[model samples]
Target: MPFYDYECAECGVFTALRPMAASAEPCDCPDCGTSAPRVILRTPNFALMEPGMRAAHATNERSTVSPKSTQAGHGPGCSCCSAKPSSRTLTRPDGSKAFPTARPWMVSH
Candidate 1:
């Protein structure tokens, strides 16, 4: 059984354990007994994809390499979060932004 969230406008939010097939069905509010619709909530996912878990495992294995290097933005392959080492970041002129560049592969956040 999976725990699901149900919200009643007249009452409040409540949780109930039910089967996956009944997840979409309305649940009775414990307080007012009114029908409450199920609400979607984010839950932790224990299952990992093939290459995804392997990469995370490899990174965890390197935790013993260096104490300071393990810090985020300073470790190898952390260039995405690390600074460019430049004295100052370039400023965008005018009201235009450089983001979502003209590249076809890039997307706006």
Candidate 2:
């Protein structure tokens, strides 16, 4: 059984647990016994759920809607996956390498 919202003429709004088949049918208000039509007041009651349970449900829903893509591509010029080395060492015309800011003992690879 799922909870559904109903708007009574006398009362503002009320919730009732009813079968899915009777979801569209008007429900008798619990307070004044007036037949009220079903209405959508809000989304599912996830706030009332436990923190861990709510996280699990969110993960499940996210996976169902959009699974993480494993084959995302990076461009050749992109720094993260580029073949070029990003070393800050400067190369002189004499073929010697100069490490301006690097530690003296740090050897270039």
Find the candidate with the highest lDDT and give its number.
Answer: 2
The CA lDDT at 77 in model 2 is 59
**Which residue ranges in model 1 land beyond 4 Å of their true spot?**
45-109
Q: Poorest 10 consecutive residues of model 1 by lDDT?
A: 87-96
User: Using Cα atoms with residue i matched to residue i, what is each candidate's TM-score against the true structure?
Assistant: 0.40, 0.45
TM-score of predicted structure 2: 0.45
**Candidate with the greatest TM-score versus the true structure:** 2
Residues 1-109 of candidate 1 have per-residue lDDT tens digits of: 9789999999888999999999999999999999999987665353555788877866776876754555755658677676677533224677444543356576534
- Candidate 2 per-residue lDDT, tens place, 20-105, comes to 99999999999999899999979888998999999999999999997775435754456775568678879999999888789989
Model 2 per-residue lDDT at 66: 79
Spell out the clash pairs found in candidate 1.
none
